[model samples]
Target: MSQLILHHYPRSPFSEKVRTLLGFKGLRWTSVIIPAIMPKPDVIALTGGYRKTPLLQIGADIYCDTALIADVLERLAPTPTLYPAESAGLARIQAQWADSTLFWTAIAYSFQPAGLQSIFGNLPPEHLKAFMADRAAFRANAPRMRVPEAIGALRLYLEQLEAQLADDRPWLLGKATSLADFSVYHPLWYIRQAAGVAGILESYPHLTAWMERVQALGHGTSEKMESGEAVALAASSTPVSTEGEAFLDLHGLARGERVTVAATDYGVDPVEGALVLSRPNELAVRRVDARAGEVVVHFPRLGFQVQKVE
Candidate 1:
């Protein structure tokens, strides 16, 4: 198997999620740091237009969304599984909630004026302005939770998490660290990084201790590689064969038809390609980039919309 290549910037919350997954799985991967904001030409070349951070690249396959990436990593390294069989369904449900509802709430609270200053304090004035503009554009058409509401909800969520851990179990879903742990960890990780804001966690000691355990996992073996090299690697390799998996289309689109797969929420940029595989929970589209040649881009069925191209 080709090296697992991750394109991410350091400060991205989702990137931290995958990075911790890599650590938890004890997998070796190549790191390709990308720009925190837009004009990400290399990423666009690989993903068509799905500009979300921490894209997982394996040979000629690009995996978007950390939810899908978690599945891919589970397939790659199954021993210390993210989804334990007995608790998989429950774990997934909790993770989905954490990734969406809890995530937005934490973001809203973490970007309060003081937290915002803490985040952009060291950056150049122009860079800070650009970052704000870029984020505003990203949030366009998306409903934002106001800071006051987010603060109330975030406190309630943390209190609940603290209660869950009060029983003295090592992890959220019991003895093992599951997908729920990682999903919940990233948002709080962001909040913890912001000055003054992390004090909120002080009220929940159990949650804070659990977070330390998750943080201690650290990013596993990773060596930096240039973006051009990763692109060349994709150009030179063939996508993993999908010969035997039967296409199961929930949408009316058929295999070999031109289609576009996009996230239903924010970061809704579409990736247009030939629909190669559609399962109950996965969708894959094969597209060819001039630099990367043929590559298969994968997205989870949840949180994404598939449409046939006219």
Candidate 2:
């Protein structure tokens, strides 16, 4: 197997999820720190256009979205599974809700005035301004939660978690930690990323305890790789599998058809290429980049919708 290369910035919550998974799997990986905002030229070189943080690079294949990244890691190392077998379906459903719903609420509450000041107090004026503007644009179309409403919702969610943990189990579902634990950890991790908001955890003893357990799974083995080196690695290696498990034919579209792929959420940039793979879980588009050579960017089927762009 080729060296696993993760392109991410430290402050990204989703990236933290991947990093923790890396630690849990005990997989050695290469890190390529990327900018937190747009104009990720080097990253676009490999991904064609999708600009989400914490992209997973395995040789010439680039996996976008943390949900898919988790799947890939689980497939690679199944022993310490992120998805538990006893209630696998339930675990997956809960994880999905946590990743999308719980996460946004946490962010909404975490970025309140006090937390924002703590996060940017030390930064230069221009840097802080840039970050704010960048995030605003990133979440342009997303709905905003009022601070009071956000706090109430978050508190309710925390109480529910407390009830789950009260069962005398270490994990949310059962004895072993599963995807549910990791999914819930990252957003709250973000809220607490700033010192001021971290104190709020004291209100929920069970939630805090579970958080400690999640943090213990460190980024197992990793060496920093420069952005340029990561791009070169993508340019040099060939993708292992263009074909995945299942396919959905549309508009009479076939494997060799010329199509475009893009995420349904933020960073709506599209990648145009020869459609190489479309499985029930993901879609792979083979695109040729002059600087990065040929690379295949894979997207989880759940968060993305595909079409034939004429």
Candidate 3:
């Protein structure tokens, strides 16, 4: 089996989600910390243009989104499953809500004046300016939640979660921790990063305890890997074959055709390649990077759009 190589930064909440999953599965992985903002030449060389943080790479196969990356991890270590049978469907639905609605709300709430200080207070002015501009571009065309709206929604959401965790239940889905816990944990975790806005979470005792439990999972065993080394690893390795796998094509595009895949929400920069795998759940493209060699980049079909290059 190819070693799990994660390209992520320390402050990325999605990266934390994957890290905790790795810890839960007790899987050791190679870690490559990429820049929080843009101009990621090495990342672009492998992903083509999908610049989302915390991509999972197994040899030449690069998984773009965390949703797909979670599936890949679950497949790799199935014992501590992300989707317990009892709460599989509900967990997926709740996770989707947390990743989208809850996440955006937390962003609006945590990036306010005082919260901004907590995040960019110590950084150089240029660094803060650059990060702001990079994120502005990233959030283009996505629905935004203003701080006022985010505060109200956050309070309501936290209250609901506190109620859910009532009676000292161990995990979100009864006995075992599922994707819902990780997904919900990350957005609120982001909220906690800003000490100013973080106090909102203190109002909910049960929710706080749940957050502590999730944090206790901790990141699993990992070793540092340089960016060039990660790219070189991709250059030398081979993408696992996806042949004979179920192909569920929603778009008219067929396998082997030139196509571009991009996120439907934010980070809309398209990754161009030959359509390699089109399934009900995933879309992959075969692209050859001069630096990274032949590589297949994969994305989840849910939030990504696939367009055949005319």
Candidate 4:
């Protein structure tokens, strides 16, 4: 089997979520540090035009989105599961809310003036300006929450989360650790990057202890790998065939036809390829590139839209 390789930057909270999950599963992975913003040429060569951070590449299969990554990891390592059977549905719902709602609110609250200084204070002025410009364009489609509104919503959400820990439960859902815990924990984890913003969490003792528990899981064993080497590895291998598997048919595009898939919310760059796998859990597109050769890129079915290419 191809060894797990994670392409991510240190500061990305979603990457931290995957890292923590790797630690939880006790799985080793190869790390390929990626640029936080655009100019992700190596990533684009493999994923066509999808430029999200923290992609999981195994041989020629590139997995985008942490939601799908969690499922892939679960399949690889069954025990100590992120989704306990009884609460699996609820777990996914909670995780989705955390990844979207809670995440945006926490980002708004954490990127205030003081938090901004903590995160980008040392950057050269031009570099900082460039970063801001890139982000503004990236988020052009989504309306941002005002800092004041986000602060209020975050505190309210934290109150509810703190109450979940009232009976000394170790996780957010109930007895077992679920994807919900990791999803919620990551944004809070990002908040702690800035002391001024993280101070808000000090009020909740139970929440603080729980955050410590999550942090203690640590990133699993990893060795650094160059981005060039990862691309070359893809060039040397062929995408695994997904034949005779149960599939989804909501997309009207004919089988093997060229299509474009893209995130509906942001990072709207489209990836064009032949529809290779159209299953309930994932959407895979087979595309060939000069550098990465032929590779099948995968994205979670949720939050992504499929458009038939003319």
Candidate 5:
């Protein structure tokens, strides 16, 4: 098997989730740090136009979105299972809520004045301006929750988590950690990174203690690899064959059709390719670039849309 390559930067919350998961799985991976904002040329080479951070690459297969990435990681390393057999359904449901609702509320709250200052204080003014412009463009089509509203929602969510942890189980679902714990940990980790807002966790002692337990997981063993090296690796490899899985054909689109797959929410840019694999819950499109050669870009069907190209 080829080395696991993760394209991410340190500050990304979703990346942190995957990193911790890697630690929990006890896997060694290659790190390819990408820019915090746009103009991610190397990433574009691998993913076409889907420029979200923290892509997982194995051979010529690229997995977009943390949700799909988590699935792929679990498939690669099954033990210390992310989706325990007993609570798989419940764990997935909770994970979805944490990744979407809790995540956005935390983002809104973390972008408050003091948090923003803490994030950009040492950076040059131009960098900050560029970051703001990049994010504004990223969120152009998405509805943003106001900070005040987000604060109230965040507090309510934290109180609920405190209650869940009140029994001292050491994990959200039970004694063993599951997908829900990691999904929920990243946003809180982001909030903790900001100087002024970290005190928000102090109010919930049990929740804070649980957060510490999750934080101790630490990112797994990683060796640095250049973006160019990662692209070259993809260029030289073939995507894993998806030959046996039955195609559900929800869109009346057949395999080998030219199509575009894109996230329905923020980061709405699409990737155009030949549809290679489609299941009820997942999609993969094969695209080729001069730098990255042939690669299969995969996305979760939950928050994304797939359309045949005209």
Candidate 6:
């Protein structure tokens, strides 16, 4: 297998989620630090405009969305399963909730005045403005939760998690950490990133302890590579050697057909190219970005739609 390449910037909470998972799995991966905002040429080269951070790349296969990225990593390294056999279903559902709901709440609550100041404290005003614009674009059409409401919900969720750990449970599940752990970890990691506002966790000792345990799992072995280098890697490499037999055919499309793939919400730029791989879980469009050259833009089937643009 080619090295697991991750395209991410340091401060992304979603990227943190995948990094901790990689550490837990003890996998070695290449790190490609992408721009934190728009004009992600190299990333667009591979993902066809699904500009979410922390995209996982294996060989030439690209996996978007942290939810799907988690599953892909689990498949790559299964020993310390993210999905435990006993309550895998429940764990996954809960993790999804934590990742989506709890995550947004924490962001809303933590990025309040002081938190935002702490985060962009030193960066130039223009950079901060650009960051805000980029994030605003990302959340453009999505409904936003009120700050107070988000804080209340997050507090309740944290309380529930605190109770879960009160029993001296080594993991969120029975004895070992699973998807629930990583799901819960990312948001708190974001809170921690807020520096000043992170003190909110002081009240939840158990949650803080769990955070330490997970954070200890440093992002699996990674070495930095330039964005151009990563692009060249993609251009020179052949597509992932998949059997291509597990395709589920959600769209009335076939491999090798020309199609367009884009995110359901943000970063709406559609990348049209030969639909190279439409496997059970993902869609890949082989397209050329003038800046990044030939690349395969990819996305998970969930939260993304595919069509044969006429």
Question: What would the TM-scores of all predictions be?
Answer: 0.98, 0.96, 0.98, 0.98, 0.98, 0.92
Show model 6 residue runs off by greater than 4 Å. Answer: 242-244, 288-295
Better of 2 and 4 by TM-score: 4
lDDT of 6: 0.80
lDDT (0 to 1) per candidate: 0.92, 0.85, 0.90, 0.91, 0.92, 0.80
Error of 3 at 186 (Å): 0.6
Clashing pairs in 1: none
Q: What is the lDDT of candidate 4?
A: 0.91
TM-score computed on alpha carbons, candidate 2: 0.96
Can you write out model 4's per-residue Cα lDDT over 1-310, one digit (the tens) per residue? 3599999999899999999999999899999998988888899999999987789999999999999999999999988999899889999999999999998998899889898888888899888889889888888779899999988999999999999898899888888988988999999999999777789999999999999999998888999999999999999998888777666779677678899999999888899999988878899999999999999999999999999988
Q: Which stretches of candidate 5 lie over 4 Å from their true place?
A: none
RMSD of each: 0.9, 1.5, 0.9, 1.0, 0.9, 2.0
- Which ten contiguous residues of candidate 1 have the minimum total lDDT? 192-201
The true-versus-predicted C-alpha distance at residue 195 of model 3, in Å, is 1.2
lDDT of prediction 2: 0.85
Between candidates 2 and 4, the one scoring higher on lDDT is 4
